[model samples]
Target: MPCPDGNAGSAGASPRKEPITVTRITDAALEVVATEGYDALTIRRVAAVLDTGPSSLYAHIVNKDDIDDLLVGRLSAEIVLPEPDPAEWRGQLLDVFSQIRDQYLKYPGVSRAALAMVPTNLEALRVREGLFAIALAGGIEPRTAAWALDAISLYVSAYALEQSLVLQRREHPDQEWVVSREELMRRYTADSFPQTRRYAAELTSGTGPDRFAFTLALILDNLCPSA
Candidate 1:
């Protein structure tokens, strides 16, 4: 089957041959992860989607984490990194982080998949490589650059996971019903926590993009002394 445009299976396609086979299992994996989150992902569920036995899925993936890793790998492939420019290294970092946040939100359960993923695979390694190049261009030490990349990725993933949980709770009202008791908690905080109430607008302001921009600015400002 020909891979759809702008999707993973599109890689390595050519007019001369049939598009690489995209198993129903692969499509189902994405669906399961997106809809149910990583904890709920299972070989049996994927097999059910493909109308195959769990035994069959075992041939392709060792377990749920294997499939989850594949999902993150697919995500990495979709991200486009910029060529390092010394003059614009900071902007490039912001773009990369923004793209990561956008992609994770788009996929819903991606934050869970990212939790244990290391940059060992080709796609992930490429991102690390790109970050290293940018960091070098900006005069950062190699060790600092590597650790900083890991730190930034962890920060972004944590934020994405928090956002995903909120969205999931909202979408699944049954889950939200239990969580709905927390409205009083917010009120309580607003009353008892002076800072929370005083700057509630600042607290809620531009949560995604604005916060990202602010974070990037703060980091860049600190790094300016080094630059």
Candidate 2:
């Protein structure tokens, strides 16, 4: 994308000298997302960000879905895969997934793209391979490890989508739909929600990351009971 400063060298920007590559396309696309939010991330918008036409992008990115794959691939580069340590596999997995979650949060609704991504992209594969190896180190069977990866990816994407929606709603100046913990606790006292009343504090307890980690632990711990 055209750097805000008009210098060729900047975050998610292309130099006049550099030929447009997939890297350039991905960078421009991210710039569009960062400035206008993910909903505004279209091939046409990315083209505008790069100071080019949509026609120029197609030679590099086949379609919208292809660009989505590239965007996930770009984000995957930021994931720091831990060296597979059998003893710390669960912790390692948590770190990787949390990194992905954070990256998705950065671009707001981009996690929705993540949900539709095929695993064939090489950058995405790198993460998948690293995660698979980690699960193997924890002594999970290959089939189980593979299936768990799908589940973990799905959950992370969904979680990030929810968070993005919350942020969007907050920007609207009408946050009444988001119940406060105290209000939720009080409401749970209704006779119809006896169990909720009894466990209100527990239900309203954890912050987002707390629940994120707790959920990851639930999946990872069972993968290797001894790990």
Candidate 3:
């Protein structure tokens, strides 16, 4: 009689291939963060998205910190660093920082993960090198250049994370702002908040990009006074 299970007995049958990999896991984790915010990102959640058990993820990633590191490293690699121009150092720095900020924004909550991280990853180190080169070429002292890079990086990451939070809030109507701008203005007028009412237009003067440019200019001016 023929074998009861045809495929089970067949020598020509193809073996199942393993689907798990570091890149696939990282991509799934980023998707979770992009769609549901950072707070929703967890090893279990990532595993679920991959249709695998949480235990399977442990073979690749050590912990949540490992995942965060990978996410930061992956995103940092996307930054396109400009060649340092001594005569155009300020503009170069501005362009580089803007690229970093835009990349973080693309990944939503990933910037929050980068806040406390040092540039241990190769890609992150490359970004640091570019910033330092620009500052140094512009005649900034070494120590001052280091400190300025730190401050600028923190500012960009914090700004991106804050914007991500605002976007998340906007996605959920139930968590909308408690006070509308019109209502806040009315309250300010009623309460006789003289300064707020007097300069309301100036206070809300710039769009997001405008405010970002103004703030970047302010930091660069103070950090590279001689430039």
Give per-model CA RMSD. 9.9, 7.8, 2.7
- What are the per-model numbers of colliding residue pairs? 0, 0, 0
- Tens digits of lDDT, candidate 2, 134-167: 9889888888999998999999999999998888
- Candidate 2 stretches with Cα past 4 Å from truth are 1-19, 174-176, 225-227
Per-residue lDDT of candidate 1, residues 2-33 (tens digit): 76678657676654632222345567878887
Instruction: State the lDDT at 194 in candidate 3.
Output: 83
| Models ranked on lDDT | 2, 3, 1
State which candidate, 1 or 2, has the greater TM-score: 2
| Model 3 error, position 218 (Å) | 0.4
Q: Order the candidates by TM-score, highest first.
A: 3, 2, 1
TM-score of each: 0.76, 0.86, 0.88
lDDT of each: 0.72, 0.86, 0.83
Q: Which 10 residues in a row give candidate 2 its minimum summed lDDT?
A: 2-11
Q: Which stretches of candidate 1 lie over 4 Å from their true place?
A: 1-25, 177-191, 224-227
